[model samples]
Target: MDYYLLPIIAIVLGFLFLILAFYLALSNARRITKLGFINLILIAVVAIACGLLLMFVFTGDLANFV
Candidate 1:
């Protein structure tokens, strides 16, 4: 139970941070230069993709544990 809790918490926190970062980027888009904004967008996309991949890879193991 404790082990499961930690991973669940981590997943929630990761999603929270992702959403916060995205909102921050969007809010600052007008102030930042176009190039910088585009870079930020790209980074966000890559990060999301990597996160999803990780989740998929781990889900099998996690399911067995649960």
Candidate 2:
């Protein structure tokens, strides 16, 4: 359990970042500049990548138990 803590925290943070990116995108929908768009895309990409990577790692670890 303790060994999984880091990946869990990372997954949670990745979701949080995704939510934050969504909120920011919606809130700034009317006047998003190029820089803002790029930032939003970067945040989304990082969040998705982090979430997916950790999920794969978690699943792979679980597979070893079965």
Candidate 3:
């Protein structure tokens, strides 16, 4: 359970970021910079998720596989 904590925390944080980004995008629909902000957040979530997954996968922990 302890071994999974980091990735789980990361995923939860990523979801929060997604929700915030969506709200921002929705609230700024008339702005020309809307898409760029949303895209940046989306990219950030993907990158963070990937990095966390990789870290867990490469740890060689057979009992707690990602």
Which one wins on lDDT?
3
lDDT of each: 0.59, 0.67, 0.68
lDDT minimum window of 10 residues, candidate 3: 57-66
List residue ranges in candidate 2 displaced over 4 A: 30-66
Cα lDDT tens digits, model 1, 1-66, are 644355455555556655655776679766667666556566656665655655655575655554
Model 2 has an lDDT value of: 0.67
**By TM-score, is 1 or 3 better?**
3
Task: State the number of backbone clashes in model 2.
Answer: 0
TM-score, one value per model: 0.48, 0.49, 0.52
Clashes of 1: 0
RMSD of 1: 5.1
In model 2, residue pairs whose N, Cα or C atoms come closer than 3 Å (at least 3 residues apart or on different chains), thus clashing, are none
Question: Could you give the C-alpha RMSD of every candidate to the true structure, in order shown?
Answer: 5.1, 4.3, 4.7
Candidate 2 C-alpha lDDT tens digits along 1-66: 564565566666767766766776678776666677677667766766776676677678754653
Q: In candidate 2, where is summed lDDT lowest over 10 consecutive residues?
A: 1-10
